[model samples]
Target: MKPMKLMKEIASDIVSLVYPHICVGCGSVMPFGGGILCAECRADFDEPVLDRCPVCGRIIYHRGKCRSCNGTRLYFDRGHSVFEYKDNVRNAVLNCKYRNMKHIGRYFGEIMADYAEKNALCGFDMVTAVPLHKNRMRQRGYNQSDIPAAMVASRLNTPCVSALERVVDTKPQNFLSREERLKNIKRAFAVRDKEAIKGKSILLIDDIYTTGATVNECAKVLKKNGASRVEFLTFSCRAED
Candidate 1:
């Protein structure tokens, strides 16, 4: 091996010894070259997705179209997701969102970008995140979805645009019934720069996809403001129930 390369590796090893990386999933010290998650945790995050809704990408019972997609109209054309939200996948998401482990977002963002690449889902006019309300943003110190969205744009060679804003501080959607979720998110978001999204095909990024209420509402607002098309991608989603 080149002497300089060997030296650099030694230096990296020394630095790692001094400040080791911690696995976010189990809070264990990470080995050299390990990812944000350890191998076992990665297995958890890699929960297999057998089948999902074409419109919302949630796991479905029988598979033609998910019951949710059939029952309620989705505003976005279609969607893609990376993992089933359960076990360590759920733990990782919660840790990233509430535990200040922002690097987890970057890690998942790379995976999301890879999924887009392998699936031929790139080449969007813009990539954007479902915005947090300014209040929520301040409280949380950041929006968990923002980093992944930005990372995806960087990976896909596109612009990451902040084209929408959460206008209302709505209650958490998981706590609400489907109908209540619809009502809660009504007018919950507003487009920031209509011209930026107008006539553009946009990819909306988020951390999770549950009932589709959040992305559907965001898509509705974007389309209403003149966007040509809108589609969503998420890190994890609810499995078949």
Candidate 2:
């Protein structure tokens, strides 16, 4: 190893010892060389659980599918999420999306990358993000989903394709009821460049999966424009059942 790089690593270790990194969920001083979180918190995080809905991959217990997906049409071939969006997961997403905490995005992206590696997510030919309308993009200054999408695409060794465009200025899905959400995003996305998606399997990346309305609608547009298959990776999902 280069001496300069080795020195930097040693210095970083010394700094961590003096001021231990804090855990995002608990605010406790993370143990030395313990990686992202302390053992206790790591144990508490119930990841890699198999109890998920077959279609959307949200956590399902006893119920066949989450109520949000029941009787609803989905356009994607499959969907997967890293964690259930509750408590710490919810706040972490809000912080990254609305509070400009981009490090949170990178952290969640690492989790998604791990899941992708374990679950053989390298089959997709291209990757894309859920598009934000021009108006909303201007208001937010950045697309929250793009950050994690970039990270995951980089990890998956695929080009992140910006193939979909949000031509319609739809109402915010969070502010609307279930019926209104479907109405708001219907026909909201369009595939601008056909050549990029034609005959390719595309992975759509997003920060959160809620009613499956938004991602499914985007997938429908991509498939209509000749995408062979559409799949998704999301950071979090709510218990809609």
Candidate 3:
């Protein structure tokens, strides 16, 4: 490399050791500096504007139940998310899951906790996360959902329970169609401790909600094993066009 380039690299290494650049959204250099996202990009994050279904939390064109959940029997009682899955929020979520940016999970978890409190969504008896199959967990070295679940539980002053387990290692839900996703996740999860969850309301944590297949299947197992109720909170969801 050129002498100047080498000097720049050495300087960057020194700065990293001292200051340590960290921005969860967009990988931008934080100027005013001290949060997950840079100030400008943080302002660009969008919240959902459309009315949502009470049960599924998908955007509804009208004021009533969403068409997606109108005829379907959902296992979870309700669901909600902090941001629409797009732009800076999307980038943050992707980095959190794929790039080992676990701090983003804790940051988003705090935000979700605030949202849950404001919306009166803190009625659950316990908190838990959708479990990864052992093989997948081994590959990833972590179940990404667990960090946020624990953080949210801490904020809510509730116990974070590892109450569900993935019995079958399934295909990534984003790669499948709605029908394929539902079939792919069927019978995939089982309750780890039925006695602990019996008659208890569970708040399930996840990173994103797409077709709702994964969380719904998890809820199915939890409810079948005696959880009195199952509801979910996620970082983002499919945006309604």
What ranges in model 2 sit over 4 Å off?
1-50
* Model 2 vs truth, CA RMSD: 7.1
Report the C-alpha lDDT of model 3 over 21-41, residue by residue, as the tens digit: 456677766654476677766
User: Could you give the candidate ranking by lDDT, starting with the highest?
Assistant: 1, 3, 2
How well does candidate 3 score on lDDT at residue 81? 77
Taking all chains together, each candidate's TM-score versus the true structure is: 0.87, 0.81, 0.87
Better of 1 and 2 by lDDT: 1
Q: Which residues of candidate 1, in runs, are more than 4 Å off? A: 1-20
Better of 2 and 3 by lDDT: 3
Error of 2 at 66 (Å): 3.8
Residue 131 alpha-carbon offset, candidate 2, angstroms: 1.7
lDDT tens digits, residue span 194-233, model 1: 8888799999999998888899999999999999889899
Error of 1 at 212 (Å): 0.8
Candidate 2 C-alpha lDDT tens digits along 10-79: 7645643453365555557776655545565565555556578878888887657766667877779899
Query: lDDT of model 3 at residue 20?
Result: 23
Instruction: Provide the lowest-lDDT 10-residue window in model 1.
Output: 11-20
